[model samples]
Target: MATGPNGSVLVLTNPHDVTTDVVLRILADRQVPVVRLDPGTDLHTSAALTATYRTGDQRGTLRTPSRELDLTEVRSVWTRRPSPFEGPPGLGEQERRFAASQSLWGAGGILASLPGAHYVNHPWNNRAAEYKPAQLAAAQRSGLLVPGTLITNDPDQAREFATQQTGGVVYKPLWNTPYKADGQAQQVWVREVRPHEITAAVAACPHLFQAKVEKAFDVRLTAVGNRLFAVRIDSPDLDWRQRQSLMECTSIAVPDRVARSVSAYLSISRLAFGAFDFAVTPTGDWYFFECNPNGQWAWQPDSITDSIAHAVADQLENGPEA
Candidate 1:
């Protein structure tokens, strides 16, 4: 575990997460040595699972034997979205159990044990970022205006909250994660809150209700290390996702307070990268919504890509603590 002069970085991701490729290419162009860890590899204890890659125009699997990673020699890691492991259909119950348990515990443990390495989005930090309640509180503590919010399983409480807001409310699921039941993908749809529908909403799941913000413009503030890129998104629809065709997005100058708060939020959240969503009123008030730790930014205006890429490379090269 020797800390070398030029350390290596491991990119933890699926093949399709294009941002991973974008970042990797930036690192490679700078001559940084990178080892890509494909998550779909078989799990048989951390020691037994040797990973191999098939290069361009190659056919059969090239089995690169397993070796323990030298954590001290590693500089940084990017924990991008990983694809789940898939085992063949013929495995019986016992074999299936062995593989599944190893995937969850064994692989996860190895990643945790890596020492003195900077992570753009660490696994533990990524987990903490998912709780919407905590994010709202943190945003306010960082001096950003967060829309009044309520998280509840009770129907009556939800109804009261909606009725109290002068401007109407909107409902967002705590986590927009989908569960597959009988081969169907169930997605959480973001929608306006009607006072009459509170009963059915409460019956469905624990709801996160917030006053719908009236806006002059909506902004997505993307921060990579110390660099910040703010983009103003214009959409007439209640939810921006609803107006993909008609919406306009453009880069905007971020207010100093908003920029400061965004930097502070990222520092407190222990993240090197974040995509922050804000709703801005015509009077110039910016209300913080939430920051996506693993947010998508390729959809943002093309001008931001270089800034983001450069920020990531600079952090990866010099280390975030520096």
Candidate 2:
């Protein structure tokens, strides 16, 4: 690793993140110094971090393989999908647990407290906005159209809610939890739920049920600071992510009202970047679904990717707007 000067960007993410790769390329092109760290792989293993607080003075340093970062000198920090710290190996279970907790809250606290560092959606804010119910509430409060939603562990309630929707309802997981069935990893996808299908299994855990939107297409709006990039997606499946290869996507204009609401939502959530999903009805009404503060975007069209990379680079280089 090479040392970076004062006021460089710090990127916390996994090595496989193509989004980070694209952003790094853009930052490099502009001669911006960046220090990338993967907490899961480097922290406590190959990297070193120290934080000291005394007499109203706070200081910290993070030494990565290629560079040493003065926490206070970080101009921007991109908290993208960095894996959890696993602590040192060869320790007993309880010892390892204690060490991991300290690493998370101690070292993590120092990074989170970096003065003068602009976090592109701080980790705490990202965790707060991840709640589906909270996201829907925020969207609705921002004047965005949101589908009637129900979260419960009662099968009867689930069935009744599904029955009330004229277009029927869909079952979506509150969180996309990775699971393994028959030794293969699987992810839950949004699927239409028939009234009868809402059985006792609903009682096993909480589920999110929403009135299905009769949509002609879907929209993915990526907001980078004040800039919004909207893309129209046409797909036959309810969850386009499942069959992404078959989906057709094109850059589209965001409605003035929708754009304003998106900006407001981001402002209210204190996010500098977000990927919002919406279902567009045939009548042109856009129904808000959810927003991923650290959503994937590099897989999108080249034009969209380049635009987002530029916006992120600009923010990291120039700091937040007044």
Candidate 3:
């Protein structure tokens, strides 16, 4: 089915992201008028936005819902890019600083006022999705095996948990953030641990510790609406990201149990999408690791692009009809 231009979509994102550009292109191809809202603008009121991006090309000088924006005409919003605001090309330091500050705070206020817009992935929902502990609990409730885990600031407790696991455990960062400077990338490595290492680990702060299960395979399950894209990620190293050249991934069917879990998890999370990571033990049992709510999908094989894109378009065009 083809779509006609009527309602508009406002995309609030960073200006420099290629992925954001691609999504905008997709939306444009569907004939939707897109309004780009930069992160660092004082956009709380619709008037501020109208003075900015809502202009001659798409819709000229027309009044939006508020002095700055007309929310009623906005059918959907995609929060694709997030970046610190930058001043227009040649502003001085003080003026630039002022603009950036207002933009940052205003963007928040504006987005908050848009309660009626259908958010593909809202900020609050995205924050909730990143909690690793919650994901593990949710996965287990859905009947997926989870490695024995511990969260504690106590050195003694940490050591005890490690000692009890059949094989020692692995320490994983709660968040998968990398520290980068000057374009030189230094990645944190995942390593096997002995019980004795807990003393130092506990000193760092509360750590997310898990039993290092011997895995036969790794699975990345990407969910879009009711459809599931399961891929088997195989590699020679403990951390696949460590050896991209040696890592291999192939499209694979989801086990019945996993498919069910994936569906249930998405429904419970109030999300239309998720990227789940799993470790399949030698015994063929799949253990849940975590799910990234704002996971990347373009890297997946092209075989599933039709369904994924279709699901997105359907949701945008026929949302909850506010």
TM-score of each: 0.86, 0.96, 0.78
Error of 1 at 78 (Å): 0.4
- The number of clashing residue pairs in model 3 is 12
| Model 1 lDDT, full chain set | 0.76
Assess the local accuracy of residue 302 in candidate 1 as a C-alpha lDDT between 0 and 100: 76
As for candidate 2, its clashing pairs are: 1-66, 2-66
- Tens-digit per-residue lDDT, 1-322, candidate 2: 2223447998889888877888899888878889998876677678989888888677888897788878778888899989787778889999988988888898778777787788887889999999998899899889999999999999999999999999989999999888999999998999999999888988999999999999999999999999998899999899999999999999999999999999899988999999999999999999999999889988789999899888888878776671
> 117-233 in candidate 3: lDDT tens per residue?
677666667678789888887787787788888888888888888889887799887876777879887677677778876676576777878999889988888776677778888
- Compared to the true structure, candidate 3 yields what TM-score? 0.78
lDDT for each candidate structure: 0.76, 0.88, 0.70
The sequence of per-residue lDDT tens digits that candidate 1 reaches over residues 216-256 is: 88888888887888888898776787767888998899999
Error of 2 at 43 (Å): 1.7
Model 2 TM-score (2 dp):
0.96
2 or 3: which has the higher lDDT?
Answer: 2
Candidate 2 ranges beyond 4 A from true positions: 1-6
